[model samples]
Target: MLNAFRARFWDLALGSAMTVLFALSGTAVALPLAVAQLLPLFWRRRFPAAALLIVGSATAAHTVLGMARAIGFFPATIALYTAATHGSPRVKWVLCPAVGVAMAAASAVRHGPVEGLLMAIVTVTVAWLAGMERSEHLRQRMERAAAEDRERLARRVHDSLARTVTVMLLQTEALRATTPLDSAAEQRIDTVLGAGRSALAEVREALAAAGSGPALGPRLEMLRGAGLRISGHPPARLPAPLQDITDRLITEAATNALRHDGPGTLLTITTVPGDGTLTVRLTTEPGGSASGSQRAGGGFGLVSLTADIHGYGGELTFGSRHPAGWQLEATFPALVPGHD
Candidate 1:
């Protein structure tokens, strides 16, 4: 909304300046034509092709009517640049050249063929090329930023969670060696050891994949073995960062559920893929009395997860479900940042 307001404000200011310039130049008769040539620029970024067509048409009319050439040329060139920069892929390449040619023909009416062609080449063609270059530069910069973010996330997971899991694995090993226990208790400890080992391996894989590894299938199987009543199938081949976030979200949410709601908690995980977006939902019902209480607002894990999700232009929401349960849902764009 703020961006739209600023664009409109810029267009208004440009239009006003052009109108004033015409009025002061003793071409007051062309003020109306100038307004027509410049008004469509207000929507130039939002509706680039349509805006370019309207602005180009009005500028052509303005030139043919013997109006101030500056008034028509300036806004037309701006529209051409915008069309090249932000227009839909289906129309951008086609519309820009067509509009450039039309505007050049109009210029010829006043400036003659040779000068008009030079003006179009120098202004319109240059503007289009500049816009394309700017667009490509912005895309490369955004991709680099996204890659950096993924690397940072991978480092955090390696430094924090991986170390913690290592400690847990060592502790479980020491307990089994030093303490006497019945067969059943030994089996439970063995289960913990297996889970810790699996987690450590998964963490290593995540680091190797730059936070985008970890097969969801095996993780879900492990969770099921841990007695979580799981449902829903995982989507295959999610984008790198998205798959990473999804894995982390599920791990964090399930850990909280098992800690707070205890073993045998019914967990329903669903993934819904939509037009350029993916939504994941996890719902957990308390299996019994609380094993532990979570800190207010779901503790640091959820807080951190929320920040990560938002960083990817996604949303993460969680709250208590009615009739005693917890729910978490995340929705994000399916594509990586700067990707098509």
Candidate 2:
């Protein structure tokens, strides 16, 4: 209660301070009107044009005032527009002041006709800059994220693919070295060859999908389609957070289910979203013995999951089920619009 009050108080205090500062130092306009241009930044992305209009309307008001006052803020507007668009650190200040003066003179000459044109120009410039910045930022971020994903995939290939291929090659060598009429060895070779070829195909697909994003839906679907009817729990959908943290966990979980339990094991990821948090539960039956460097060492995917969740200001936990089975669980705070 105290912390919440403190937070609210700080919010009020900051807002009030900003309001006072803008009123005193700004064009002596009210808070809502003067700072109105920035309202678009807080709007939902789906309503982009509306957001642009809001910012532009505010810009129009500001530009008109600055023109009448002969105060040079047109360059600042251009800079704001540019910063918001190209998101570049430095905006060309060259013509902004000149533009402002000209706009003011034009406004006077036309008795407010040019005011609309100047406002439109400023609005368009800011909108274009914001959009360009967003696009470039998203593209760069996706590229980095894709690169990380591919790196993780390359590791998986190095681990599982190399091991599977080696087994295949060794099995082939053993089969060749077997004497004539080696029925048992011949049958083993058939199994090994089949497994190897399947593994090779899977590896190739993984490599292809590395830099690319995952196919939609559950990871187990990939395993089940590959002829592993391994089951320990039930059907599971990934948490939204895990959607951003796939590859390693997906591979590890599937590997454990397939290798540890062989086949016919049920695995389920249970999700419970409530009370400003999202909970994830992964349950595996008797076959839930966790493998991999971290899990095998009794180190925590739960801990990591918790850290990840808490990074978003949430929590996570893991434990044995009531009656039986091993369970992994995570809880994350759901993002609330305009709450930030």
lDDT of 2 by residue, 1-340 (tens): 3544554565456445544555555553444655654434433122333443454455445555552222223323433433333221212132223333444444444345455456544644564456456545544554565578567868878787678797777768675677564788778777777888787777777777666456534666777775444433432343333455433343445555555554554566555644223455666554334231223322454355455555544455555555544455555433311222
Q: What are the Cα lDDT values of the candidates?
A: 0.73, 0.48
| Predicted model with the maximum lDDT | 1
For model 1, what is the C-alpha lDDT against the true structure? 0.73
Q: All candidates' TM-scores?
A: 0.62, 0.43
For model 1, how does the per-residue alpha-carbon lDDT over 253-281 read when each residue is reduced to its tens digit? Answer: 77777767877887788997643467899
Give the lDDT of residue 13 in candidate 1: 92
Clashes of each: 0, 11
Q: Which window of ten consecutive residues has the lowest lDDT sum in model 2?
A: 86-95
Tell me how candidate 2 scores on lDDT.
0.48
